[model samples]
Target chain A: MALAADPMAPIAARVARVRRELKDVWTIDIEVGSGGFPFAPGQFNMLYSFGVGEAAISISGDPARPNTLVHTVRAVGKVSGALTRLKPGEFVGLRGPFGAGWPIDVAVGSDVVLVAGGLGLAPLRPALYRLLATRENYGRIVLLCGARSPRDILFRIELERWRRRLDIDIEVTVDHAAPDWRGNVGVVTTLIGRAAFDRHHTVAMVCGPEIMMRFAASELVNAGVSDEAIYLSMERNMKCAIGHCGHCQFGGDFICKDGPVLTYRHLRDRLARSEI
Target chain B: MDMVQSDERSILTRAGLDALIGTLAARGYRVVGPKLRDQAIIYDDIAGVGDLPAGWTDEQDGGHYRLEQRDDNALFGYAVGPHSWKKYLHPPRLQLWSAKREETGFSISHEPETIPPFAFIGVRACEIQAIAIQDRVFLEGPHVDPHYQVRRAGAFIVAVNCGKAGGTCFCVSMGTGPCAKSGFDIALTELLPGTSEPIYVAEAGSEKGAEILSSLPGRAAQPAEIEAAEAVVTHTAAAMGRSLETAGIRDLLMSNLNHPRWDDVAERCLACANCTMVCPTCFCTSVEDASDLSGEEASRSRRWDSCFTMDFSFIHGGSVRASTKSRYRQWMTHKLATWIDQFDTSGCVGCGRCITWCPVGIDLTEEARAIRDAPAQEAKP
Candidate 1:
């Protein structure tokens, strides 16, 4: 077969490791060649699994290490199922580090609030790393995490280690948890009101299902946070991650390029509709 | 004459049309023109004037299109069909890339296309605008579609100003048709009045058009013939069978998204996506990958997609616009409302293929008017 006349061509990369994070969810560590592919924090890569298919998975690794890219994908469909089953040393096709990254510049020097639900944490993980690495540059950083149950929690060991730090305030929550679960029993939106952060100086970064973001954003708004300061990560079925496929158009904006991360103020009208 | 200035005009007899085709073929160009097929005039490969639907026009309305025989021998008398010029420029199915199984894993190969410049004959003014609109969508972005770029850059446009309007046509309201304003190499107006035989008052829109015109059998058009051609276009403009009220239309659609008018349309709409398939400017697409029986080699391809599909708005959980009402609203709002916000121009070119091809005969202009003219009613879920 002939290669596509497009920038959508993927570069070969080797899967270094695969860790089962939760039920039907995994985090794969991949490494490109010598120079190590450099990319921004919130950008994602199009991972192709041979004959199965391709999908957009966010880069979840530390930005400091550019060569080793990490992506966490849930086994929701065929392509992701194929990806989660790959063993170490297996090669995969990768196309990017495409799309806009989390706005670290605007979040800098301000109190940061990170809210993630279920697998949504994967896209925001790199931003959290940058916040912790430059801890002194930004104000107090709070991480509020949520999942379906205790077993669904991702990066369990890392969340524990982060809890030990005095600077990073972490709150964990789950829905329909077992009776013995010690974390908060309600949704993540409940965690926002009591969470400690200066409302005026805080920059809230949120990523989750569309409904969850809606409730969480409203809670933030009601809590005296301005819409401009809250950023939400938007996802669409992106065929060409560079924006030409037109699959990811959220109204006039191409969610792939104009943003995977758009300010609440910008997307407020679009987000309210049942369909846009 | 002096290299045929841009404003230079000529009279192209029936025989001269064939000579133009010969000129394009001699220059190694594939001439794609409107030909009668499947009872509709579709753009296809044509050898000469005989292939054109001479003396044939079309009657078009919502969910209606049928060929009609005309008294005159004028070519380029029909409205658009289910297919747009996009099928040629931006193809329906395009291979994005391929991954060959390697000893280690896969060796990815990039597919670059070198498309031969094609001569597009019998193109309408609205289609010229449609192609220009798609150019912005594919080319103006940070990522320019290489395939679209290759084909579009290589294309030679030969526009035909409408001498008759279809029942569904509202290109006049959209300010895109009835006459070719720009974005053409050559433009022709077929003037078949009561007195004289059929003649095309042709004008050179670009240097290439002038070069082609110089080779064809034509002479400087008499001043009276030019007036007759202008009269033909003016008559078509006045004879528009459909009209859309565009004053603040974008805001009207955006604000009334939840109006009961949407529910009314949804009741009739089947979500079959025929309108989008026929539209000139609906550019949404989806991609898929296929492998051989060996499973060692694979190729990915992108194909035309419509918002009416359940998967078009799909995420990991489910489709966002699952309901018929939501899907219909997305299509109309995107076409008339959000497209202006995205591309600084309306997505519609006023070529009413959607109305003509719609299975339910859902007229977008009528729907918009129903929403705009009616007093605001409580939105139904």
Candidate 2:
């Protein structure tokens, strides 16, 4: 409501916890100020590093706990490169809790299927926590995860704990692995076919590289899932997450405002094209 | 106060126009009007009536612009030029804020926004519509751009009806120009019937415009003179050189997303972005953070950007619209098709500055028509 204030003015957040996920990847938990805005599960934050630029990182923590904000960063660019090296008690600028998150309400009564690839797991982790917290709200829960290799797996301890739960079925695959590894060694779409689920009652949420998402969506389609039942977290160049900068325009929709999470029926045509 | 009444029309002599400029200046407003510079008429500081582009008209076509001498000293003799009101209102470069690293933390400071009230003279009807289109972009968005709002709020518009249509103009087709409608403080019509002394017919559109008109020497317009003023607008509308069909255009463009016509255009397009730069309504921008040599202080600034550039759509891996074919498709589809979906209006005001400024002489009207008239392609679903 305060249009007077500079929308570029970022609120300062203190880094409370920093956990190394893998090579070039880290999970940061920030102590958001009391005035910080509450975010939904799929929303993202523009994390700014002093002397460096900013990056749009999705909220990787639980949404129910409103005080602390969590984001996972890969050291790909100037901002995230600085972010991966940050320590506890350091400060970073934050602006948002932006974009539409996963469809928790729609997936409430139906069976839930979560598919994530590589670092794609970070954005969908919040939705997974929300689903686990309200375990009785949905039918069967199936999580299929894929990483480049065995050592690249994220949140290993948490995945083990979720594996122990009796109500949920979890399968993880690595594109390549060492000789000692004892799990599925193939691309993620293979797991989709093997996962046990009644296709008519299922709601699927997918997040990964664009190519991987395309292949996974095709696999889901081939396996009898309706287009409306499959959703994806899409990403493009994002500048002003509020939709004014014009960086995130995907056709008529600004990916930052209209979606980061959209149904397959909403984006399949655009995604099928090579460079849309 | 009756002199400042709404909808009052008056005839101002060529000399009285100078008084109007002096009156606006006395009210602490910087009066900027169009002047001939570098073979083009552009907005700049005005001293009086002598500073305007008098006795000069422009000839425009694809990839060409030249100034020509008019038979009479008509001030508003030409259609729109390359420079638009956005140069002052939304400005090409603006600093949002600057941050400096302090001893323990960082302190952010914003550059003081100092917007002087400005009286923009010689605004065309299509340019007015262009400004209103930009208003929807900068003001009506979810997060308003504060700097654009500041400059726009301080602007005083004096719109002029087109007296001559350039070779590339198509405002009649867009229904946005060739005549001034609303969104102006005052509307001006320059009449030159037979090379006699030029007289301006002024219509006050706002109380401020009327107040300024009250200070100038003018008289009530005769009924025949009023009809003559309307006739000037009618002639300009009918003289437009090009037209674009608007009915179901949004659907026609949106449905043919992958049409091969884009590739045909891409072969000729250098992607120099001259079209987007000259266009009055294109609002795309890129933000960059610049730190000083010491790397202690930095400011984030937003600059006008074009979608035709490869880097404009860059994400983590590479650009989204990488190919020239895709970039041209994105710009055209967004301007013609998806813009209707987003803004409920066409992005183009039909000024045709793009057609005149494009180096390849690639007219968008011709391109749109080619897409519509091409035999139904089986590949485009």
Question: CA lDDT of each candidate?
Answer: 0.86, 0.85
Q: Candidate 1's residue-wise lDDT over B32-81, tens digit each?
A: 99999999899899999999998898999999999999887878778888
Model 1 quality (TM-score): 0.96
lDDT of 2 by residue, B86-175 (tens): 888777888888998775457788877656788898899999999998899878977787777877887788888888988899988898
Give a tens-digit lDDT track for model 2, residues A1-276: 112677777766788999889998999999976755588878899998876778899999888777889899888988898888888888888888788999998998999888999988998888988998998999999999999999999887899999999989999999999999999899998999999888998899999998999899889988899989999999989877877778789877889888999999888877877676
Model 1 pairs whose backbones collide: A3-B110, A3-B111, A4-B96, A4-B97, A4-B111, A5-B111, A5-B112
Q: Could you tell me how far off, in angstroms, the CA of residue A93 lies in candidate 1 after the best superposition? A: 1.0
Instruction: Score residue B100 of candidate 2 by CA lDDT.
Output: 84
After superposing candidate 1 on the true structure, give the runs of residues whose Cα lies further than 4 Å from its correct spot. Answer: A1-5, B1-7, B110-114, B193-196, B375-381
List the pairs of residues colliding in candidate 2.
none
Candidate DockQ values, in order, are 0.56, 0.55
Error of 2 at B197 (Å): 2.6
